[model samples]
Target: MTYHHTQYLEDGSIASTLADLARAHRILELEGHGDMSMGHLSYRDPFGRGLWLKRGNLALSEVVDDDFILIDFDGNVLEGTGLRHIEWPLHAEILRARPDVNFVGHSHSHFATVLASSTEELLPYNNHGIWFAYEGVPRFADTCHIITTVPLGVDAAKTLGNAQALFLANHGIAFVGSTVAEVTLTGIFLEKAARFQVDLKSSGFTPILPDPEEAKEKFDRIYPPKAQHNFWTFFNRRLDRVEALQGIGISQISLPSAV
Candidate 1:
Protein backbone atom coordinates (compact mmCIF):
# COMPACT_ATOMS: atom_id res chain seq x y z
CA MET A 1 0.00 0.00 0.00
CA THR A 2 3.02 2.27 -0.10
CA TYR A 3 3.64 4.66 -2.97
CA HIS A 4 7.10 6.04 -3.75
CA HIS A 5 6.68 8.93 -6.15
CA THR A 6 5.90 12.43 -4.90
CA GLN A 7 5.12 13.81 -8.32
CA TYR A 8 1.48 14.36 -7.42
CA LEU A 9 2.57 16.94 -4.88
CA GLU A 10 3.33 19.34 -7.69
CA ASP A 11 0.27 18.60 -9.74
CA GLY A 12 -1.88 21.74 -9.95
CA SER A 13 -5.09 19.74 -10.10
CA ILE A 14 -4.13 17.85 -6.96
CA ALA A 15 -3.19 21.08 -5.22
CA SER A 16 -6.56 22.61 -6.15
CA THR A 17 -8.36 19.54 -4.85
CA LEU A 18 -6.46 19.75 -1.57
CA ALA A 19 -7.33 23.41 -1.36
CA ASP A 20 -11.01 22.50 -1.68
CA LEU A 21 -10.52 19.86 1.00
CA ALA A 22 -9.03 22.48 3.27
CA ARG A 23 -12.00 24.76 2.65
CA ALA A 24 -14.31 21.90 3.56
CA HIS A 25 -12.52 21.66 6.90
CA ARG A 26 -12.93 25.34 7.62
CA ILE A 27 -16.51 25.40 6.42
CA LEU A 28 -17.39 22.49 8.67
CA GLU A 29 -15.65 24.23 11.53
CA LEU A 30 -17.94 27.23 11.11
CA GLU A 31 -20.94 24.88 11.02
CA GLY A 32 -20.13 23.28 14.41
CA HIS A 33 -17.69 20.56 13.32
CA GLY A 34 -15.02 22.23 15.44
CA ASP A 35 -13.92 19.97 18.29
CA MET A 36 -10.61 21.62 19.11
CA SER A 37 -8.58 19.81 16.45
CA MET A 38 -9.96 16.36 17.26
CA GLY A 39 -11.98 15.79 14.07
CA HIS A 40 -10.43 15.12 10.65
CA LEU A 41 -11.24 14.82 6.94
CA SER A 42 -9.70 12.88 4.06
CA TYR A 43 -9.71 12.78 0.27
CA ARG A 44 -9.00 9.65 -1.72
CA ASP A 45 -5.93 10.37 -3.79
CA PRO A 46 -6.67 10.83 -7.48
CA PHE A 47 -3.53 8.86 -8.34
CA GLY A 48 -4.78 5.82 -6.37
CA ARG A 49 -1.80 6.03 -4.06
CA GLY A 50 -3.71 6.65 -0.80
CA LEU A 51 -5.79 9.18 1.06
CA TRP A 52 -4.63 12.70 1.83
CA LEU A 53 -5.48 13.15 5.50
CA LYS A 54 -5.52 16.29 7.58
CA ARG A 55 -2.49 16.16 9.83
CA GLY A 56 -3.04 16.18 13.60
CA ASN A 57 -2.48 18.97 16.18
CA LEU A 58 -4.35 21.65 14.18
CA ALA A 59 -7.95 22.69 14.44
CA LEU A 60 -10.10 22.22 11.33
CA SER A 61 -9.98 25.96 10.70
CA GLU A 62 -6.20 25.92 10.73
CA VAL A 63 -5.91 23.42 7.88
CA VAL A 64 -4.62 24.52 4.48
CA ASP A 65 -3.50 22.79 1.33
CA ASP A 66 -0.03 22.12 2.76
CA ASP A 67 -1.33 20.66 6.02
CA PHE A 68 -2.21 17.25 4.57
CA ILE A 69 -0.10 14.09 4.46
CA LEU A 70 -0.60 11.28 2.00
CA ILE A 71 -1.03 7.95 3.76
CA ASP A 72 -1.80 4.51 2.40
CA PHE A 73 -4.54 2.12 3.51
CA ASP A 74 -1.95 0.44 5.76
CA GLY A 75 -1.57 3.77 7.64
CA ASN A 76 1.94 4.42 6.35
CA VAL A 77 2.73 8.01 5.47
CA LEU A 78 3.60 8.24 1.81
CA GLU A 79 4.00 12.01 1.31
CA GLY A 80 3.98 15.38 3.07
CA THR A 81 4.94 15.89 6.72
CA GLY A 82 3.05 16.21 9.99
CA LEU A 83 1.87 14.15 12.93
CA ARG A 84 -0.91 11.92 11.60
CA HIS A 85 -4.14 11.48 13.53
CA ILE A 86 -4.52 8.20 15.43
CA GLU A 87 -7.88 7.80 13.64
CA TRP A 88 -6.35 7.49 10.19
CA PRO A 89 -7.83 4.03 9.86
CA LEU A 90 -11.30 5.54 10.14
CA HIS A 91 -10.75 7.38 6.88
CA ALA A 92 -8.57 4.71 5.27
CA GLU A 93 -10.93 1.80 5.74
CA ILE A 94 -14.03 3.75 4.71
CA LEU A 95 -12.43 4.93 1.49
CA ARG A 96 -11.09 1.46 0.90
CA ALA A 97 -14.51 -0.08 1.52
CA ARG A 98 -16.44 2.42 -0.60
CA PRO A 99 -15.13 2.84 -4.10
CA ASP A 100 -17.76 5.50 -4.88
CA VAL A 101 -16.71 7.62 -1.90
CA ASN A 102 -13.96 10.10 -2.66
CA PHE A 103 -14.30 12.30 0.41
CA VAL A 104 -14.81 11.36 4.08
CA GLY A 105 -15.34 13.46 7.21
CA HIS A 106 -15.61 12.79 10.92
CA SER A 107 -16.73 15.30 13.51
CA HIS A 108 -18.17 15.66 17.03
CA SER A 109 -20.72 18.33 16.28
CA HIS A 110 -22.92 18.90 19.33
CA PHE A 111 -26.38 17.86 18.13
CA ALA A 112 -25.32 14.83 16.08
CA THR A 113 -23.31 13.47 19.00
CA VAL A 114 -26.21 14.20 21.34
CA LEU A 115 -28.66 12.37 19.09
CA ALA A 116 -26.22 9.50 18.73
CA SER A 117 -26.45 8.92 22.48
CA SER A 118 -30.25 8.57 22.24
CA THR A 119 -32.38 5.78 20.80
CA GLU A 120 -34.56 7.96 18.56
CA GLU A 121 -34.14 7.75 14.81
CA LEU A 122 -33.50 10.70 12.47
CA LEU A 123 -36.79 11.20 10.66
CA PRO A 124 -37.46 13.35 7.61
CA TYR A 125 -38.68 16.31 9.63
CA ASN A 126 -37.30 18.95 7.31
CA ASN A 127 -35.23 19.56 4.21
CA HIS A 128 -32.06 18.82 6.12
CA GLY A 129 -33.42 15.43 7.08
CA ILE A 130 -34.68 14.70 3.59
CA TRP A 131 -31.21 13.97 2.25
CA PHE A 132 -30.91 10.98 4.60
CA ALA A 133 -34.54 9.87 4.40
CA TYR A 134 -34.06 7.03 1.92
CA GLU A 135 -31.27 5.36 3.88
CA GLY A 136 -31.73 6.26 7.49
CA VAL A 137 -28.62 7.15 9.43
CA PRO A 138 -27.28 3.95 10.99
CA ARG A 139 -25.58 3.67 14.37
CA PHE A 140 -22.29 1.94 15.13
CA ALA A 141 -22.11 0.96 18.78
CA ASP A 142 -19.20 -1.45 18.44
CA THR A 143 -16.82 0.52 20.69
CA CYS A 144 -16.23 4.09 21.75
CA HIS A 145 -12.49 3.61 21.50
CA ILE A 146 -10.51 5.40 18.82
CA ILE A 147 -10.55 3.55 15.49
CA THR A 148 -6.80 3.15 15.09
CA THR A 149 -6.68 -0.47 14.00
CA VAL A 150 -7.62 -2.09 10.73
CA PRO A 151 -10.22 -4.44 12.21
CA LEU A 152 -12.00 -1.68 14.12
CA GLY A 153 -12.01 0.49 11.04
CA VAL A 154 -13.38 -2.41 9.01
CA ASP A 155 -16.15 -2.99 11.53
CA ALA A 156 -17.10 0.70 11.50
CA ALA A 157 -17.13 0.63 7.73
CA LYS A 158 -19.39 -2.38 7.85
CA THR A 159 -21.83 -0.46 10.03
CA LEU A 160 -21.78 2.38 7.54
CA GLY A 161 -22.70 0.02 4.64
CA ASN A 162 -24.54 1.95 1.87
CA ALA A 163 -25.56 4.88 4.10
CA GLN A 164 -24.05 8.28 3.45
CA ALA A 165 -23.38 8.71 7.17
CA LEU A 166 -23.02 6.75 10.43
CA PHE A 167 -23.43 7.61 14.07
CA LEU A 168 -20.61 6.25 16.21
CA ALA A 169 -22.61 5.78 19.39
CA ASN A 170 -21.76 8.42 21.99
CA HIS A 171 -18.65 9.22 19.99
CA GLY A 172 -19.12 11.26 16.81
CA ILE A 173 -20.19 10.96 13.17
CA ALA A 174 -18.60 9.59 9.99
CA PHE A 175 -19.90 10.79 6.61
CA VAL A 176 -18.79 9.89 3.10
CA GLY A 177 -19.62 11.01 -0.42
CA SER A 178 -18.32 11.01 -4.00
CA THR A 179 -17.18 14.67 -4.01
CA VAL A 180 -16.13 17.43 -1.68
CA ALA A 181 -19.39 19.35 -2.01
CA GLU A 182 -21.50 16.29 -1.30
CA VAL A 183 -19.55 15.22 1.79
CA THR A 184 -19.26 18.68 3.33
CA LEU A 185 -22.96 19.45 2.84
CA THR A 186 -23.86 16.05 4.21
CA GLY A 187 -22.03 16.80 7.45
CA ILE A 188 -23.64 20.21 7.77
CA PHE A 189 -27.11 18.93 7.02
CA LEU A 190 -26.72 16.00 9.43
CA GLU A 191 -25.88 18.35 12.24
CA LYS A 192 -28.81 20.63 11.45
CA ALA A 193 -31.19 17.71 11.20
CA ALA A 194 -30.03 16.34 14.52
CA ARG A 195 -30.42 19.69 16.17
CA PHE A 196 -33.98 19.91 14.93
CA GLN A 197 -34.77 16.45 16.30
CA VAL A 198 -33.24 17.32 19.66
CA ASP A 199 -35.26 20.53 19.82
CA LEU A 200 -38.45 18.78 18.78
CA LYS A 201 -38.06 16.25 21.57
CA SER A 202 -37.38 18.96 24.13
CA SER A 203 -40.60 20.70 23.10
CA GLY A 204 -42.50 17.59 24.17
CA PHE A 205 -44.49 17.37 20.96
CA THR A 206 -44.71 14.23 18.90
CA PRO A 207 -43.26 15.26 15.58
CA ILE A 208 -44.73 13.92 12.38
CA LEU A 209 -42.27 12.40 9.93
CA PRO A 210 -42.75 12.57 6.19
CA ASP A 211 -43.87 9.46 4.36
CA PRO A 212 -41.01 7.20 3.25
CA GLU A 213 -42.08 7.11 -0.39
CA GLU A 214 -42.56 10.89 -0.61
CA ALA A 215 -39.26 11.49 1.14
CA LYS A 216 -37.46 9.28 -1.33
CA GLU A 217 -39.02 11.16 -4.20
CA LYS A 218 -38.08 14.55 -2.73
CA PHE A 219 -34.53 13.31 -2.18
CA ASP A 220 -34.25 12.36 -5.82
CA ARG A 221 -35.59 15.69 -7.03
CA ILE A 222 -33.54 17.92 -4.73
CA TYR A 223 -30.22 16.11 -4.52
CA PRO A 224 -29.23 15.86 -8.12
CA PRO A 225 -25.63 16.69 -9.10
CA LYS A 226 -26.54 20.24 -10.08
CA ALA A 227 -28.33 20.86 -6.79
CA GLN A 228 -25.27 19.66 -4.91
CA HIS A 229 -23.11 22.09 -6.81
CA ASN A 230 -25.51 24.92 -6.04
CA PHE A 231 -25.51 24.11 -2.35
CA TRP A 232 -21.73 24.14 -2.25
CA THR A 233 -21.68 27.47 -4.02
CA PHE A 234 -24.08 28.94 -1.46
CA PHE A 235 -21.90 27.75 1.42
CA ASN A 236 -18.73 29.13 -0.13
CA ARG A 237 -20.46 32.46 -0.65
CA ARG A 238 -21.65 32.37 2.93
CA LEU A 239 -18.12 31.63 4.04
CA ASP A 240 -16.90 34.56 2.02
CA ARG A 241 -19.27 36.89 3.85
CA VAL A 242 -18.21 35.47 7.22
CA GLU A 243 -14.55 36.09 6.41
CA ALA A 244 -15.29 39.61 5.30
CA LEU A 245 -17.20 40.48 8.46
CA GLN A 246 -14.46 39.02 10.64
CA GLY A 247 -11.76 40.99 8.82
CA ILE A 248 -10.09 37.76 7.67
CA GLY A 249 -8.53 37.57 4.24
CA ILE A 250 -10.46 35.73 1.58
CA SER A 251 -9.22 32.21 0.85
CA GLN A 252 -6.95 32.13 -2.15
CA ILE A 253 -8.16 28.66 -3.00
CA SER A 254 -9.60 28.62 -6.53
CA LEU A 255 -12.78 26.70 -5.87
CA PRO A 256 -14.53 25.09 -8.80
CA SER A 257 -18.23 25.48 -9.53
CA ALA A 258 -18.43 21.86 -8.52
CA VAL A 259 -16.06 19.36 -6.88
Candidate 2:
Protein backbone atom coordinates (compact mmCIF):
# COMPACT_ATOMS: atom_id res chain seq x y z
CA MET A 1 0.00 0.00 0.00
CA THR A 2 1.13 3.54 -0.72
CA TYR A 3 1.77 6.00 2.14
CA HIS A 4 2.45 9.71 2.27
CA HIS A 5 5.59 11.22 3.77
CA THR A 6 3.79 13.85 5.79
CA GLN A 7 5.48 16.87 7.30
CA TYR A 8 4.76 17.69 10.95
CA LEU A 9 4.61 21.43 11.55
CA GLU A 10 5.06 22.41 15.17
CA ASP A 11 2.23 24.91 15.10
CA GLY A 12 -0.25 25.92 17.82
CA SER A 13 -2.22 22.78 18.71
CA ILE A 14 0.33 20.41 17.26
CA ALA A 15 3.09 21.88 19.39
CA SER A 16 0.97 21.55 22.52
CA THR A 17 0.04 18.00 21.60
CA LEU A 18 3.63 16.92 20.99
CA ALA A 19 4.69 18.36 24.35
CA ASP A 20 1.97 16.34 26.10
CA LEU A 21 3.09 13.21 24.31
CA ALA A 22 6.61 13.81 25.59
CA ARG A 23 5.37 14.40 29.11
CA ALA A 24 3.28 11.24 28.90
CA HIS A 25 6.47 9.25 28.45
CA ARG A 26 7.87 10.69 31.66
CA ILE A 27 4.65 9.96 33.51
CA LEU A 28 4.61 6.38 32.31
CA GLU A 29 8.20 5.90 33.44
CA LEU A 30 7.48 7.46 36.83
CA GLU A 31 4.62 4.98 37.19
CA GLY A 32 6.98 2.05 36.46
CA HIS A 33 5.21 1.19 33.24
CA GLY A 34 8.25 0.97 31.00
CA ASP A 35 9.52 -2.48 30.00
CA MET A 36 12.81 -1.75 28.33
CA SER A 37 11.75 -0.10 25.04
CA MET A 38 8.87 -2.43 24.22
CA GLY A 39 6.04 -0.12 25.19
CA HIS A 40 4.64 2.60 22.89
CA LEU A 41 2.02 5.32 22.70
CA SER A 42 0.34 6.85 19.61
CA TYR A 43 -2.13 9.53 18.71
CA ARG A 44 -3.84 10.14 15.37
CA ASP A 45 -2.15 12.95 13.49
CA PRO A 46 -4.43 15.94 13.30
CA PHE A 47 -3.27 16.48 9.75
CA GLY A 48 -4.24 13.12 8.31
CA ARG A 49 -5.11 9.46 8.92
CA GLY A 50 -1.49 8.84 9.90
CA LEU A 51 -0.30 8.28 13.48
CA TRP A 52 2.40 9.97 15.57
CA LEU A 53 4.35 7.51 17.77
CA LYS A 54 7.68 7.44 19.57
CA ARG A 55 10.63 5.83 17.83
CA GLY A 56 11.34 2.17 18.61
CA ASN A 57 13.63 0.84 21.36
CA LEU A 58 13.81 4.17 23.13
CA ALA A 59 13.11 4.06 26.84
CA LEU A 60 9.98 5.97 27.78
CA SER A 61 12.03 8.53 29.69
CA GLU A 62 14.22 9.14 26.63
CA VAL A 63 11.32 10.07 24.38
CA VAL A 64 11.33 13.62 23.02
CA ASP A 65 9.61 15.68 20.33
CA ASP A 66 12.08 14.44 17.72
CA ASP A 67 11.44 10.86 18.76
CA PHE A 68 7.94 10.98 17.32
CA ILE A 69 7.45 9.34 13.92
CA LEU A 70 4.57 9.48 11.50
CA ILE A 71 3.33 6.20 10.04
CA ASP A 72 0.35 5.05 8.05
CA PHE A 73 -2.13 2.18 8.29
CA ASP A 74 0.26 0.04 6.24
CA GLY A 75 3.01 0.49 8.86
CA ASN A 76 5.24 2.50 6.54
CA VAL A 77 7.39 5.13 8.26
CA LEU A 78 6.33 8.26 6.42
CA GLU A 79 8.25 10.78 8.54
CA GLY A 80 11.15 11.11 11.04
CA THR A 81 14.10 8.75 11.51
CA GLY A 82 15.06 5.88 13.86
CA LEU A 83 13.39 2.47 13.94
CA ARG A 84 9.65 2.12 14.32
CA HIS A 85 8.16 -0.19 16.93
CA ILE A 86 7.96 -3.85 15.87
CA GLU A 87 4.31 -3.74 16.86
CA TRP A 88 3.39 -0.62 14.93
CA PRO A 89 0.69 -2.65 13.23
CA LEU A 90 -1.12 -2.80 16.56
CA HIS A 91 -1.64 0.95 16.36
CA ALA A 92 -2.21 1.12 12.63
CA GLU A 93 -4.98 -1.45 12.28
CA ILE A 94 -6.75 -0.32 15.43
CA LEU A 95 -6.96 3.28 14.27
CA ARG A 96 -8.25 2.17 10.89
CA ALA A 97 -10.96 0.09 12.55
CA ARG A 98 -12.06 2.43 15.30
CA PRO A 99 -12.89 5.99 14.45
CA ASP A 100 -13.78 6.81 18.05
CA VAL A 101 -10.25 6.08 19.21
CA ASN A 102 -7.62 8.75 18.63
CA PHE A 103 -5.10 7.67 21.26
CA VAL A 104 -3.60 4.20 21.73
CA GLY A 105 -1.10 2.91 24.28
CA HIS A 106 0.61 -0.47 24.37
CA SER A 107 2.74 -1.58 27.29
CA HIS A 108 4.29 -4.60 28.93
CA SER A 109 3.64 -3.15 32.36
CA HIS A 110 4.76 -5.50 35.14
CA PHE A 111 1.48 -6.14 36.94
CA ALA A 112 -0.51 -6.10 33.72
CA THR A 113 1.72 -8.70 32.11
CA VAL A 114 1.53 -10.85 35.22
CA LEU A 115 -2.24 -10.71 35.28
CA ALA A 116 -2.49 -11.46 31.56
CA SER A 117 -0.35 -14.55 32.06
CA SER A 118 -2.98 -15.95 34.40
CA THR A 119 -6.23 -17.66 33.48
CA GLU A 120 -8.30 -15.35 35.67
CA GLU A 121 -9.49 -12.03 34.31
CA LEU A 122 -9.37 -8.66 36.07
CA LEU A 123 -12.25 -8.23 38.53
CA PRO A 124 -13.65 -4.95 39.74
CA TYR A 125 -12.70 -5.29 43.36
CA ASN A 126 -12.77 -1.58 44.07
CA ASN A 127 -13.63 1.81 42.62
CA HIS A 128 -10.48 2.08 40.55
CA GLY A 129 -11.10 -1.33 39.01
CA ILE A 130 -14.81 -0.84 38.49
CA TRP A 131 -14.45 0.72 35.02
CA PHE A 132 -13.30 -2.62 33.64
CA ALA A 133 -15.95 -4.67 35.43
CA TYR A 134 -18.77 -4.36 32.91
CA GLU A 135 -17.42 -6.37 29.99
CA GLY A 136 -14.38 -7.64 31.90
CA VAL A 137 -11.79 -6.25 29.42
CA PRO A 138 -11.35 -8.24 26.21
CA ARG A 139 -8.51 -10.72 25.83
CA PHE A 140 -6.58 -11.38 22.62
CA ALA A 141 -6.25 -15.12 23.14
CA ASP A 142 -3.91 -15.65 20.22
CA THR A 143 -0.13 -15.89 19.96
CA CYS A 144 2.11 -13.78 22.21
CA HIS A 145 4.45 -13.02 19.33
CA ILE A 146 5.00 -9.38 18.40
CA ILE A 147 2.19 -8.11 16.18
CA THR A 148 4.41 -7.34 13.21
CA THR A 149 1.99 -8.15 10.39
CA VAL A 150 -1.10 -6.34 9.16
CA PRO A 151 -3.15 -9.53 9.57
CA LEU A 152 -1.99 -9.82 13.17
CA GLY A 153 -2.93 -6.23 13.83
CA VAL A 154 -6.34 -6.78 12.30
CA ASP A 155 -6.88 -9.81 14.53
CA ALA A 156 -5.95 -7.82 17.60
CA ALA A 157 -8.34 -5.05 16.66
CA LYS A 158 -11.13 -7.58 16.16
CA THR A 159 -10.53 -8.85 19.67
CA LEU A 160 -10.70 -5.32 21.06
CA GLY A 161 -14.17 -4.73 19.53
CA ASN A 162 -15.89 -2.02 21.56
CA ALA A 163 -13.91 -2.41 24.76
CA GLN A 164 -11.62 0.27 26.12
CA ALA A 165 -8.76 -2.15 26.72
CA LEU A 166 -7.35 -5.52 25.62
CA PHE A 167 -5.26 -7.95 27.64
CA LEU A 168 -2.93 -9.73 25.26
CA ALA A 169 -2.89 -13.27 26.50
CA ASN A 170 0.40 -13.93 28.24
CA HIS A 171 1.76 -10.67 26.86
CA GLY A 172 0.65 -7.23 28.07
CA ILE A 173 -2.02 -4.56 27.68
CA ALA A 174 -3.32 -2.35 24.83
CA PHE A 175 -5.69 0.47 25.63
CA VAL A 176 -7.68 3.02 23.55
CA GLY A 177 -9.21 6.42 24.17
CA SER A 178 -10.46 9.60 22.57
CA THR A 179 -7.78 11.72 24.22
CA VAL A 180 -4.23 11.33 25.57
CA ALA A 181 -5.34 11.88 29.15
CA GLU A 182 -8.03 9.21 29.00
CA VAL A 183 -5.74 6.57 27.53
CA THR A 184 -2.84 7.37 29.87
CA LEU A 185 -5.03 7.39 32.95
CA THR A 186 -6.71 4.15 31.90
CA GLY A 187 -3.42 2.43 31.20
CA ILE A 188 -1.96 3.41 34.58
CA PHE A 189 -5.06 2.55 36.56
CA LEU A 190 -5.55 -0.70 34.69
CA GLU A 191 -2.16 -1.90 35.86
CA LYS A 192 -2.87 -0.82 39.41
CA ALA A 193 -6.21 -2.63 39.38
CA ALA A 194 -4.62 -5.79 38.07
CA ARG A 195 -1.95 -5.67 40.75
CA PHE A 196 -4.56 -5.25 43.45
CA GLN A 197 -6.61 -8.20 42.21
CA VAL A 198 -3.58 -10.47 41.89
CA ASP A 199 -2.38 -9.58 45.39
CA LEU A 200 -5.81 -10.12 46.87
CA LYS A 201 -6.33 -13.46 45.16
CA SER A 202 -2.90 -14.61 46.30
CA SER A 203 -4.10 -14.24 49.89
CA GLY A 204 -6.34 -17.30 49.37
CA PHE A 205 -9.55 -15.43 50.08
CA THR A 206 -12.55 -14.40 48.09
CA PRO A 207 -12.59 -10.70 47.31
CA ILE A 208 -15.97 -9.02 47.24
CA LEU A 209 -16.76 -7.23 43.98
CA PRO A 210 -19.17 -4.45 43.20
CA ASP A 211 -22.37 -5.23 41.38
CA PRO A 212 -22.12 -4.80 37.61
CA GLU A 213 -24.98 -2.33 37.43
CA GLU A 214 -23.65 -0.17 40.23
CA ALA A 215 -20.14 -0.36 38.85
CA LYS A 216 -21.29 0.85 35.44
CA GLU A 217 -23.18 3.69 37.10
CA LYS A 218 -20.11 4.82 38.96
CA PHE A 219 -17.94 4.52 35.85
CA ASP A 220 -20.33 6.70 33.89
CA ARG A 221 -20.26 9.44 36.46
CA ILE A 222 -16.54 9.33 37.17
CA TYR A 223 -15.15 8.95 33.64
CA PRO A 224 -16.95 11.79 31.92
CA PRO A 225 -15.63 15.05 30.48
CA LYS A 226 -15.48 16.84 33.84
CA ALA A 227 -13.58 14.06 35.57
CA GLN A 228 -11.06 13.72 32.71
CA HIS A 229 -10.44 17.47 32.84
CA ASN A 230 -9.77 17.36 36.54
CA PHE A 231 -7.52 14.29 36.42
CA TRP A 232 -5.58 15.49 33.38
CA THR A 233 -4.96 18.86 34.97
CA PHE A 234 -3.72 17.27 38.18
CA PHE A 235 -1.25 14.98 36.41
CA ASN A 236 -0.06 17.69 34.00
CA ARG A 237 0.77 19.85 37.04
CA ARG A 238 2.98 17.08 38.38
CA LEU A 239 4.68 16.88 34.99
CA ASP A 240 5.14 20.66 34.93
CA ARG A 241 6.79 20.58 38.36
CA VAL A 242 9.29 17.97 37.23
CA GLU A 243 10.08 19.75 33.94
CA ALA A 244 10.47 23.06 35.73
CA LEU A 245 13.38 21.80 37.81
CA GLN A 246 15.17 20.69 34.65
CA GLY A 247 14.47 24.01 32.91
CA ILE A 248 11.97 22.45 30.48
CA GLY A 249 8.49 23.66 29.59
CA ILE A 250 5.31 21.58 29.25
CA SER A 251 2.42 23.94 28.74
CA GLN A 252 -0.79 22.66 30.29
CA ILE A 253 -3.02 21.48 27.43
CA SER A 254 -6.69 20.86 28.10
CA LEU A 255 -8.66 18.01 26.64
CA PRO A 256 -11.47 18.99 24.32
CA SER A 257 -14.88 19.22 26.01
CA ALA A 258 -16.21 16.41 23.84
CA VAL A 259 -13.32 13.97 24.32
Q: Which stretches in model 1 have alpha-carbon errors above 4 Å?
A: 1-12, 247-259
lDDT of 2 by residue, 20-128 (tens): 7776776776565777667889989888859988898687766776778889877788888989888899998899899999889898877777777777778788766
For model 2, the superposed segments whose C-alpha errors exceed 4 Å read: 1-12, 242-259
Candidate 1 lDDT, 93-148, residue by residue in tens: 99999999999999998789988877778888989999898789999887877788
Q: What lDDT is obtained when candidate 2 is compared to the true structure?
A: 0.76
Candidate 1 weakest ten by summed lDDT: 1-10
In terms of TM-score, the best-performing candidate is 1
On a 0 to 100 scale, what is the lDDT of residue 135 in model 2?
64
Point out the worst 10-residue segment of candidate 2 by lDDT.
1-10
Per-model TM values vs. the true structure: 0.89, 0.86
